[model samples]
Target: MADVPTHLALGVEYDGSRFHGWQSQPDHRSVQQTLEDALGRIAAAPVRVAASGRTDAGVHATGQVVSFTSAAERPDDAWLRGGNSLLPAGVAVRWVARVDPSFHARFSATARRYLYVIQEQPQRPALAGNYVTWSRQRLDDEAMHRAAQVLVGEQDFSSFRGAGCQARTPMRCIHQILVRRFESLVVIDVTANAFLLHMVRNIAGVLLDVGAAQRPAEWVGEVLARRDRKAASKTAPAGGLYLVEVHYGDCFQPPPPMAPLPLSGIRDLW
Candidate 1:
């Protein structure tokens, strides 16, 4: 055989409501499986791909990065078009790029970003329930923002980590975190070098308490200082979370994120 491997990267977006998650599982549908099946059909051979990160069930993604090596000899446009055409309605490949052979999706990423959108109305939404989390309690986005400032910089996030997390260390550096309101949506946007399992959702749960006046904003800081998972509020629902971007910092390139809640006038790169 005279086949040569071609390394390629792809930008993907998916609505995770009906999918088990980004990782493949037994007897369950996953974004990775769906992607591999589609790409395999295009390549006329089975293809295994690696993603920037694995998202939990019901969690969405607008800027997921995937990498694979194939000898299919297809152009970038072919991979992109063929993938989208074969994928289910909830998943789509936004772009494809030929990359250096050494490039690996997860290992080469410099940072990752996520967004959690909440619907803070008195009634649960009937239309956007799968996309946004509904909260009947009155929320104070300003207070949540003020408290989130404590999370910036390198710190031990053990208090917010999931019980079953396999990360070797609890220390992670958060580049930025902001909680804000856009119309009916309360958005929590975060960027970090890496994250512990359930870190962002745990942070959101604590802030939700502050927003509801059930706890003072300063309590969030206390929770971090406690360094115990039970010290923080329960983890927020997976439906509200979005894996929005995986940054490479010039080492590689992937498409920019598509905001889950695109309420106009958002000047920031959230």
Candidate 2:
């Protein structure tokens, strides 16, 4: 008798510096392609993975959720420990569990969170290069936080949308946004129901201008009101961005994912 297919969910984390991005690409390596290959070896057949969100190039992830179905009869832990052994150093399967066939990684997600870490100093980070964004000027995180409040609630984000973004609409609901500092590091944390391509990065760019005193906090509202992309600041660097969490509805008992800490631990800043 044929083994019935088992629906599986995995919490995966990766150092985005190791791949082009999360999605598979024909010419460039990707986190999805690498993970699928390792898991395919364990399933003894081809495997396909769908992630909660498609992170961009150079963006790290600490709580990426993925779903796949396999007919293999290996123990559940095989997907975690066995796959890790076959995978390279930058990525790992953090957890594995059986899931209802109805659950879809992309569709089932209710909210997503991201953190953008900026190292503020005249000197560039040595060990933290490519994992944190570098800024020459010290920023006023308070001003940035105050300005960000305009973004809450369902609103049109056409000012931040990418030209090539294919989302059906320019509207999205931002659940929360916080800009704070830990010593020389300024972090921008955002949680939203969903995002358009480069949306968060554009928001960060505008906040950077506010923090640097180039623009007043009220300018954020003005930019949003304009509904034009050209009115916003340049898109922030992808390296500073990290997909830190994904939220599911009440029925799922999801594990708490770690924060998007920089290579230099946050405590080190103190």
Candidate 3:
């Protein structure tokens, strides 16, 4: 049999609230299932997809990447048009490009970036409903920024990992942890070599405590030094979290141009 290519990278985005998670479930909706279904339709053959990482239910992504392999070759446009034609409304393929047979999407990524938005207001805005989490209590944004600084650099983030995480190591190199407030919104941006499950949300939760004066700014540093999971606060709501970007090694090229599709009068597949 002829050799089949091993890598086909796709830049994707989705509103994860509607799915069980990224991986396919036997009876529940999932981002992987949706993408695989669309790919299968496009290729006229079954396709299995592997993503950079799984995002929990209700989480969202603006720059999630996935890859798979097939014996068939198709242009980037085919992946865009054919895949999008079969996918449901909330999921989209932003770009598609061919890659080396050995380029694994998950394993090749050097870092991942996440952003969490917090609306610090007495009442949530109707317009921003699905994009941010509303915290009615007043927050000290400066304090939050100070607390976030302690998280930069390498550390064992056992305190911020979710209980369900399966990663073998608790240590990760954090490139940046920035907390900025604009108007009534507080934005937390984190970039790391890798993250444990729910790491970003858990960090956000701990920062929330600092912002609300429930914990001192130094507490963040103390928690990291302790390497204990119980040192952190609750995980933040998934609705406010988004996988905003991913970085790879120098070998990868920029993705192909994306053709704009009309927003209206479009029918979607199940």
Candidate 4:
């Protein structure tokens, strides 16, 4: 008798420095390809994985989520142990749990949060060289924060989009935008319903210009109003960006309830 398939959601973390990107590509190493390969080895057959979102090359994720189905009945540990055993170094399965059949990892996500980190010290970060951007110049955190405020709420972000982006619409709702300084580090945190390709990097680049006093805070509003890609600053390096979290609806109990805390008071960025 054939067994019913069980749906499972898996939380993943990976160092994106080595892979081409999260999506599968011919003749190239990718996060999806590596994950599928691991799953296939464990199940002794082909396995497909749907991710919460696709990340570009050199973009890392700490809380990336994926979901898959299996006809064989196996405990959650089976997924962790089996998948990790086949996965290469730099990629890991944090946890796996049963999820509703209707749950679509990408579509069901309510919000996505990303953090961009910049080390402003003169010397490069020896340990974090591949994880963060190193900038020797002093940054004006106040100016950057002031510029970020202009991007809050629903807006047409065509100016910040990449030329190769395939999203149907450039409109996206930004729930939060924050810029803070911790000694020599500058952190930019953004939460949104969705994001366009290169959106965060482009926004960070523009904000970096503002922080360096190369561009005024009003330039952000001007760029948004223009809806022209050329009006925005250049896209920043991918190493600085990290997918920190993804939020689902209240019905899912996989992630424990988050206690209410002062939103702007949280200082640890990424």
Candidate 5:
């Protein structure tokens, strides 16, 4: 008799510096491909994984969620420990649990959170080179926060979306955006119902312009109204971006804390 397939969910954390992205590509190494391979080895069969979001190349994630179905019947802890043993140093399965058949990692997600870390310094970061973006120009965290508020609520994000973005619609609701400074690091944390390709990076670019005084805080609203990508600043670097969390309605527990550093109480809007 054939056993019923078991649906499983996982929490993953990875350094994206060494892979192409989270999705599988033809010849390039990707986070998804790596995880699928590790899982396949454990299941003794081919495995496919679907993530809560698809992060681009060089983007890291501390709380990525994924779902898959298998008949291996391995214990939850075994999936966590065994998958880590097979994965590379840059990636690991942080948690694993059995989920209901309806619990999908991507579709079941209600919101996604991203964190962009920037180092404000004349010289580049040495210890955190591949993990952060550096800017020589001074940034006004206050101005950035003010500018980002224009993005709250549902709106067409064509100005910030990637050219190659394939989402059926350009409208997305940004639940919150907070800009703060922690020592030398400036963190931009955003929560959205969903994101278009390169959306957050483009928003960060525009906020950088506002912080540098090249553009007024009101410019963000104008760009949103224009619905043209060229009106916004160039997309920021991928290294600074991190997929911080994915929210599900009732299926999974909260992810482990990867809390931000101490902040300067810059500003944040719910």
Candidate 6:
């Protein structure tokens, strides 16, 4: 009789500035390739992994979840410590566990959360240049916050999706969106069932325009109604984007959320 494969889940954190993306690509560095290679080494055989989401090139992640089936008999900590020993500095296996065979990393996820950080300053950021998108112009956080609220709930997001997105439907549900500023940094937090290619960046680009007074807050609603990608602002730079978390059912537990300082502001973005 053949041995049944053991299903395992892992949480990963990576600095994506150097990788091509999350998916494996020929002749290019990828988070998947780096991780799978490490896992294969630990298992002493080829192992494949499926992630909760495939993040784009130059986009970072702190709460990425991945799952794989393995025949190797190893304890959970072995997957974590052993994998980290082989991975490069850009990526790390944060945690590992054996999950029920029914738990799939991607499909089982309830929602995904992302955060984009904009450094609103005159000169370019010297300390955190690789981690933030720099903007010289001042941004109105209140206006951006108000404009972002229109994105809540289920709707067609074709206007925000990038070209070559493979998702058959343009419709997606956004659970929450918060735009706030701390010191010189403006952070945009969004949660959704899933995301299309360039959706978050595109949304950020448009909100930046609104905050900069280049467009009216109401224009976002018009853009959404148009369903034309051309009507939206250019995609924001990838450096500022971070995949913050992926939500799962009671079968899995996620890590703690990032805690930032308090934000004070008026209600409307005008």
**Candidate 2 lDDT, 1-270, residue by residue in tens:** 899999999999999988999999999999999999999999999999999999988889988999999999889889999999999999999899888999889999999999889999898888888888899989999999999999999999999998899899999999999998888889888999999999999999999999999999999999999999999999998989988788888746568777665634554321
Task: Determine which window of 10 residues in candidate 4 has minimal summed lDDT.
Answer: 256-265
lDDT of 2 at 198: 93
The C-alpha RMSD of each candidate to the native structure, in angstroms, is 1.5, 2.1, 5.7, 3.6, 2.7, 3.9
TM-score of 4: 0.93
Which regions of candidate 6 are displaced past 4 Å? 258-270
In candidate 5, what residue range of length 10 has the lowest lDDT sum? 261-270
Q: Give me the runs in candidate 2 sitting further than 4 Å from their true place.
A: 263-270
Pairs that collide, model 5: none
Each model's lDDT:
0.89, 0.91, 0.82, 0.85, 0.88, 0.88
Kindly list the per-residue Cα lDDT of model 6 for residues 125-214, writing each as its tens digit. 786777888899889999999999999999999999999999999999999999988778798999999999999999999999999999
Q: What digit string (tens of lDDT, one per residue) describes model 3 on residues 45-142? A: 89998888889988888778888997766778999887898899889898887888778778988988888888877876686666687889978989
Highest lDDT, which number?
2
* Candidate 1 clash figure, as a count: 0
Per residue, candidate 4 scores C-alpha lDDT tens digits across 24-95 of 999999999999888777776778999988999999887788988877677778789888988999888888
Q: Give candidate 3's TM-score.
A: 0.90
**C-alpha TM-scores of all predictions:** 0.96, 0.96, 0.90, 0.93, 0.95, 0.94
lDDT tens digits by residue: candidate 1, 1-270: 888988999999999997999999999999999999999999999999999898888999889999999988987888999888899989999888988988888989989999988887788889888888789976999999999999999999999999999999999999999988877789998999988988988998998888888999899899999999999998999888998889998888676567775433566654
lDDT of 5 at 222: 99
Which parts of model 1 have CA positions greater than 4 angstroms off?
Answer: 261-270
Candidate 2 lDDT score relative to the true structure: 0.91
Better of 4 and 5 by TM-score: 5
Q: Poorest 10 consecutive residues of model 3 by lDDT?
A: 261-270
